[model samples]
Target: MSWAEVGQRWKLRLVQVDWYLCLGLLFLLLVVISLSMGAWKLNLIVNDADALPIEAVAIRGERARTSDEEIQVALQDLMKRSFFSADVNQVQDALEALPWVYQASVRREWPAKLKVYLVEQQVVAHWNGDAWLNIHGQIFDAPKRSDIGALPLLAGPEGQSKVVLTTYRQVSELLKINGFKLDSLSLSPRHAWHGSLDNGIMLELGREDKMARIQRFINVYPTLVKQSKPVAKVDLRYDTGLAVGWENAQKESQ
Candidate 1:
């Protein structure tokens, strides 16, 4: 071959070698980067294994019936989990499961701590014969206590707790204006309503226009209570008037 042809062939071989070298270096670079990334990911996972453990738990709330020991017992299951793995929602659910706890909030503090806040149920009245009613009319069962005897008794059909509670508040407030305090209120299965006052007087508020009936009784209460005999029962089922039953008066006539 001629010298010029030899030189051209050599140039072509050098160019091919240069291209192969570039490709090989690029492949090596990619391999190195992949290994480095894998090592970095592995290091991160290993470090997470040593993440701070939960060391302390703080519970905060107005606790009257539910004690701190009870709350701690509820959190026992959660204590098994790492600080990062523990779920706030699960904690809250556990706390709210307590009989007197109305609501619970849970949060994770930095490093190794958990914070919990709870709202206890506010007893508004005694429900049925076993449960107690909160201000929101939610019924919950709790251990019987003597201190709760003063709360007014409320009874109704299932699922009517809220309605009964609302009506009780309205009626009691109206009664308060007339210097009467409701001791107990009840709604019969047939929807009839009745109440007993603190003064031992029973009120019969029949269904339909019960509020108006009650208002009528309130308007005439002062005059009726001023009579010689103590009032025993006041039937407010009439349109314009109420039937007043005097204590011992029926026995005297007999």
Candidate 2:
């Protein structure tokens, strides 16, 4: 209200601005000097990377023997310190390119560091062509024999591999509950699904409401098993009901 009060208010505002300026300069110095120091230098100064209280490599693994192009792009983006405008996506995209990685999510753990969460690829199916499909429906070359798992094998066209892999999982579970074993499943380009049973029968399920059809099959499997029905194959595609071809009289007697 008075000139003296106005002067006091301006003085306080100037002090706050000066405080902010000092904090900004301090941060800039840390980025320029501290971050510029190499891994060796940091080891000499800080007891550990975690002790630094800002940057920490949460996961440590040899960056999955990839080409230099992808690694260089990831490293360059990580070394940047502009803070607000660090192209985070560029860094994440680079990391995601690694064959061992299924999905990678990057988050700024603020005041200093970035956190990376990698859902490493878990090979669910071993493809015939020396490759595997990750749980995320992504395909990558299989690791060494020591690294590959004893999972089921799936083979199909390149563009349709994922669809086949995912659908197999669903149908295989369906069979397991009904005390049946699955051989393999194939997906046609026309969106039709077919499967083979371990008992040497080729079952075909046409493209349609998959859940409803599978539910119907699950419900009727026990009856067929009880009738000792020699079911060679059970086709659930027909609108009326299931069509089961006879397997043999031995199963029928049982």
Candidate 3:
């Protein structure tokens, strides 16, 4: 009717729109909470439900690291009781509690299943004794050597594994896979990388083009071995072929 009245009406319309949006957001939040919650039946559906049995979990479909007797004990505890239900977060926390699990994700897989996925800690390097720092930046005690192989052995001070692996990959490509094995890889503080062979010979691969340097070694190794002249240590830090140190000729006195 009047200018003031028109302005008042506009203000009222804006307030109504804001109220509806707020109501919509509140409804969405309620729906999410409803979908998320599980009726635990007073924690009765999941037997031994307060905290999961970490030792009993078989994440990534792997068998337990402990003995068969231990497994039987877990089964005994599981079966003697009735339903004790748990939520996905509880299961995830249980999985992460294990020493080897790096990180885990748990989700509801609908009416019947609660799915779990785990990324187990990897052996990055052997630290001092038998423990290894994994890829996820956590450390766990390593299994006996017999229990693991096909993994590169990283040697350096603590926390040097990531650096050594970077260099190892560069050098590893040049060598013929059938003829040689990378026994151990090491890195210096300045980031120099070197490796040893099973025969105890050392290889010096300077900071760059390590792949090319390794290839050069591959080309020269067979020829030296054939001549009955094995080099004590081979240095590829030079720009040209190689600087070789020889085993003292038994006839050095001559």
Candidate 4:
């Protein structure tokens, strides 16, 4: 072919390729749009079918401090959302915010329902005369409860609850064996240990050998009880022997 005629034919072929490329891109765009619309329609259908919302909330756990009304109140807002669209993390957080709920789990039940399992806090002692201490020695503030007044009172600086609880348990066990009931325990800012018995006797355990000092008190309790006046306080911070403060002495002085 002539050079001019060959150049004209090559231009036509290039134009045809460009048209084919545009058509292919247009076809791919349509397919993507179709798939997206189909997905959106499917989601709409699912939501329409779930118009019933969460009809029931099944709570499964051993709850003593957390009441049924409390759980219902916590989940009131979450129940308005459809099961398919409900936020499980938000539900879990709401339930966990209850005063007694230590941990919570939320899951869908394959229908228009939600399942919530809650773990309640196990209160072991009163902390700082205001808050509460769980068995794990974690501090949590709760409303003033009349039923918890019988629990042992434990006091110490912040972040030392576990240490005070451990010492309380150890010393309480020792005193209980000798018929002494430990009513309260305190850790001073100087790291001294002190306690009060149910019988109104105060104990000064000092900074060291608390167990040994408690043991000494138990050993001498009988001898102290046989005295003429009742023992009001026992100071066991010494290396050997202890000081006894008589209750009547104060009464007579007064």
Candidate 5:
């Protein structure tokens, strides 16, 4: 071919390359725009307050003291939001705030529901006359109902519930073997321990070696009952022997 014809062919080839590059860039821009629109649409659906509304809360676990009305009250405002927006931790906190609820777990089921598992406090004794002590030695306050009057009474300073509870269990077990039921237990500010039996006999357990002291009382219990009057009180604070006070005010040192 001639030189001028070859130059013209080279210019045509360069124009074809530019057109292809433009088409490729246009396709990539279209893809990016489509992806952006899809993401925005998805965000609208996920964030819409009317979507995925929570309609019910399924409460599980054994519930005895926790009333239905109490659960409703705790969840009323929390469940108004969409399921995805609802905070499980907040729901759990509300349920656990109830007087009888010991622990609570909250979770979201598929679609639009909440599952709440609650654990109720198991009351074992009355604490300091107004509150209650659970089996775990935790103190919780509830209404003073007629049914709880029969439970054993335990008293102690703040933050000593576990200590008092442990001692009460140990002593009660020993006394129960001797045909006695521990009715009340108290720990003094001076760290002294005292207890009363169902039969109205008082025990002064003092500061230390309380279990050993109760054992000493059990050993001499049969001999003490032989007295003419019922024993009113027994002081087990001594190292080797205990003092007995009769119901008739007759006191003797064993």
Candidate 6:
């Protein structure tokens, strides 16, 4: 055959090959979509039977406030799904949603089981008069109990939990050096801060430079307390000096 004729034949063969490839790809895409949409329900039944079915769930963690029953209840829906089909993140979220759970991890075990590890919240202080603040500064609510009332109280505006927690830690450490214990700390709506000591002395740390003022008070606290009777309150809003409300005498400055 002539060169041109050979070239035409080769072009026609290439076109035929392309057409076959396109048809094959279209068939594969349709199959995938059908399977995804559950159009072929029989395949689902067959695959589910073949997949590793979750026969048991094992929960491991320190449980003080949260019970095993609570965790089981949270994972009830997960138990319905097979180990391969259940969402690990969803299961973890469910467990963490519990009042006492601080964090949770869920993993699939070999041959049909789920292993869940839980970390319960460790209450550090009373928050906002209603909730509890964990060691990580997260706020959570639980049923009131007598033991919780003894914890140091911390109050602040919404979305200020971390700020309040930080202040509490810093102030508590500073006061500890002076042999005093912080009982409660509050931040007012006007951004003013105040604290009560275990000895019934109150501190008014005004809006700006609260930590600085508190430190200043700490520096002179020993001398001030020794010079006079135990005071009831100290106002640390001044730039150079502080005002003290004595237990019996009029307010004095130092």
> lDDT for every model?
0.88, 0.69, 0.63, 0.90, 0.90, 0.85
Q: Report the Cα RMSD per candidate.
A: 4.7, 13.0, 11.8, 2.4, 3.9, 7.1
* TM-score attained by model 2: 0.48
Query: How many residue pairs clash in each candidate at the backbone level?
Result: 0, 1, 7, 0, 0, 0
List where candidate 6 sits over 4 angstroms from the true fold. 1-53, 145-149, 219-230, 248-254
CA shift of 209, model 6, Å: 3.0
Regions more than 4 Å wrong, model 5: 1-41, 250-254
* Residue lDDT tens for model 3, 1-254: 99999999999999999999999999999987776665344344455543333233333444434343533343444323322344556556655656555667765443334455666666655543456756643447635656755555666666765666665555664453747867677766777777887776789988887778888888888877776666677899988789776666523734
Candidates arranged by TM-score, highest first:
4, 5, 1, 6, 3, 2
Measured with C-alpha atoms, the lDDT of residue 18 in candidate 5 is: 99
The number of clashing residue pairs in model 3 is: 7
Which ten-residue region of model 6 has the weakest summed lDDT?
A: 42-51
- lDDT-better candidate, 2 vs 5: 5
lDDT of 1 by residue, 1-254 (tens): 89999999999999999999999999999999999999987666534524546788888888888987998899887877777777889999999999989999889898788998889999999999889999999999878866554899999999999999999998999889878899999999999999999998999999878778778888898898789899989998887888989989866877
Off by over 4 Å in 1: 1-52, 146-149, 249-254
Tens digit per residue, CA lDDT, model 4, 1-254: 89999999999999999999999999999999999999998787666535647788889999878898988898787777777878899999998889888999988897788888889999999999989999999999878766654899999998899999999999999989888899999999999999999999999999999999999999998999899999999999999999999999968878
| Between candidates 2 and 6, the lDDT winner | 6
Off by over 4 Å in 4: 1-12, 39-52, 147-149
User: What is candidate 6's local distance difference test score?
Assistant: 0.85
- Candidate 6 residue pairs that clash: none
Candidate 1 vs 6: which has more lDDT: 1
What is the per-residue lDDT of model 5 for residues 133-173, given as tens digits with 9 covering 90 to 100? Answer: 99999999887666454889999999999999998999999
What would the per-residue lDDT of candidate 6 be over residues 1-254, giving only the tens digit for each residue?
89999999999999999999999999999999988778557556533734656788888989788887987798887777766677899999999999988889989888788898888889999999889998888889888766554889999999888888899999899889878899999888888899999988889998888878888888888877796587888999999899988876644333
Q: State every prediction's TM-score relative to the real structure.
A: 0.77, 0.48, 0.55, 0.89, 0.82, 0.73
Rate residue 16 of model 6 by lDDT: 100
